[model samples]
Target: MMNKGRLYGVGVGPGDPELITLKALRLLRSCPVVAYQSADDKESIARGIVAEYLPGNQIEVQYHLPRALDPYAAQPIYDEVVIPIQEHLAAGRDVVVLCEGDPLFYGSFMYVFTRLSDHFETEVVPGVSSPMGCASALAVPLSYRNDVFSVLPAPLPAEVLEAQLLNADAAVIIKLRRHFTKVRDVLHKLGLASRARYIERGTMANQRVVSLDDMDPSQVPYFSMILVPSKSHL
Candidate 1:
């Protein structure tokens, strides 16, 4: 029997076509099977990014990852999610799974990769992450010389968030949608609200960037991200 085929976990970059790396674009164009995640719809942002590079009538697989408040409860959903792709890999078909931002950065690719590793060869191509793109879209530096950067989930407790802000030279808080108001309160309490900046939709066409003080949560989308650059260390 032929060896099980390799898997290409391609990062489609952060909401921009040109941002895709040469390596990722090349792989997508060459792969017979291209896969991506679809949430509540058949198409997705990540899929749109690589659409140009894909072959006509090529095999396109959509893996549906469960959208739940808790990642643990969603484990079973993901297991069921990758089964079709796994089946393709087992049949010796090289599959390219398109992911948003970087494959390893808070992405679904990691979940599938971890479970499918024993059965097939998997390669992850790093792409520009959302935070970096968010920073770039604002024309601001995420970190300066000797600056420390910490990435934390927005759902972190108020105290934990405060302590992290106190120590890091710079910090990025992701998943800012549900926790936006809480994160805003913590920043305000720590007197860091003025220094904070929010970017919604990152590098996408509808992206928005502004100082935290001026932001209205109602205007922010679920894809929103916030950055707090340390002014004290300057």
Candidate 2:
């Protein structure tokens, strides 16, 4: 009987190629099939991060799990995207799936993990997530001693965001694309606008750190983040 292939969920880190971990690189190269999230026209960010390291002869699979949809309603969609990865594993060929950040930390790989972990051997490699990457790029401390930190997605309603901010000493605002104006207004109302720092594509070659107040709402990208660092100083 042919043994089933092992499945690996490898985190490629934020955007910098050097951010890839030794373990991730090892498995990434050893796997016969490499899978990543991709759009019809654009290369996946996860793949782009480690493009130079790819061996070039391995079979590559691209899957897209659409965003902004109801989770319950997206089950069939998630099932459909992972079919390519499952087919590779079924053939007894080890597969390495690339994730932008830590696999469990709001990663796209979750779709694959939830569906395949029960049927196949699986491993996940952690990588530097957006908040940590942005904090380093901004050269600001994320939290001080005894400080509470929170990750607030920008799509959240103003009242909900305000409440979360009220309790957090430090916060990272993510997914700011279309919700930038709403989040900006909420931060101003809570007197946190001045303390917030904005950046786009942190740790990448095109990284840009912009003052929060000066950021144009219409121009915010999916890779942008707002860091509200702890006020306490050492």
Candidate 3:
């Protein structure tokens, strides 16, 4: 029997195409099969970042995993996408799964990695996470000496969000789509609203960086993030 091909989870960074690691670029170009998560409309942020690196002859696969409020609801979509990936590995054709930010950091690639790792030789190429990218874009330091930095996904309940925000010295709230108002209100109540910054499409060409005070909570994208700097450091 022929040896199975290796699977690579490549993080393409937040939004800047140049932020992609050299190793990731190499793997993307060399791999025969390239896969990325996309909407039903076939749009994928990860694919856009690595588009230049993908060779013309490479077989591109888009898994239409629609954005959802409940993460568990996407399991069925993952199951469907895994079949073709497994087939490629079985055929001894290496597959590169494109991911945004670090593959393991609140990324869809985690779902794929967990399912495929035991069955195939897998490796992860890390990239700059959105929080880090947002920090750079806003010229804010994420943490200072002895400062605790927390990362919170905005999908949690308002009470949970408030509790965590109150305890952390600094925090980043990600997935700030429809939950913008709730996150903003929580920050305001904690007296950290003025200290926070809102960043949309960080490191991208059209990136927007604004103070949380000035931002209108209603009109925010899913790619947005809120950076709450450490009070001690500030």
Q: Return the TM-score for each candidate structure.
A: 0.92, 0.98, 0.94
> Comparing candidate 1 with candidate 3, which one achieves the higher lDDT?
3
For this target, which candidate reaches the highest lDDT against the unseen true structure? 2
Instruction: Give lDDT tens digits, candidate 1, residues 37-134.
Output: 88775577898877776778679888878655487888888888899899889988899999999999888898899899877888889999988988
| TM-score top scorer | 2
Q: Lowest-lDDT window of 10 residues in candidate 2? A: 36-45
The alpha-carbon root-mean-square deviation between model 3 and the true structure, to one decimal in Å, is: 1.6
lDDT-based ranking: 2, 3, 1
**CA deviation > 4 Å runs, candidate 1:** 69-71, 232-234
lDDT of 3 by residue, 81-190 (tens): 78888899999999999999999988888888888899999999999999999999889888888877899999899999999988888999998888998888898898
TM-score order of candidates, best first?
2, 3, 1
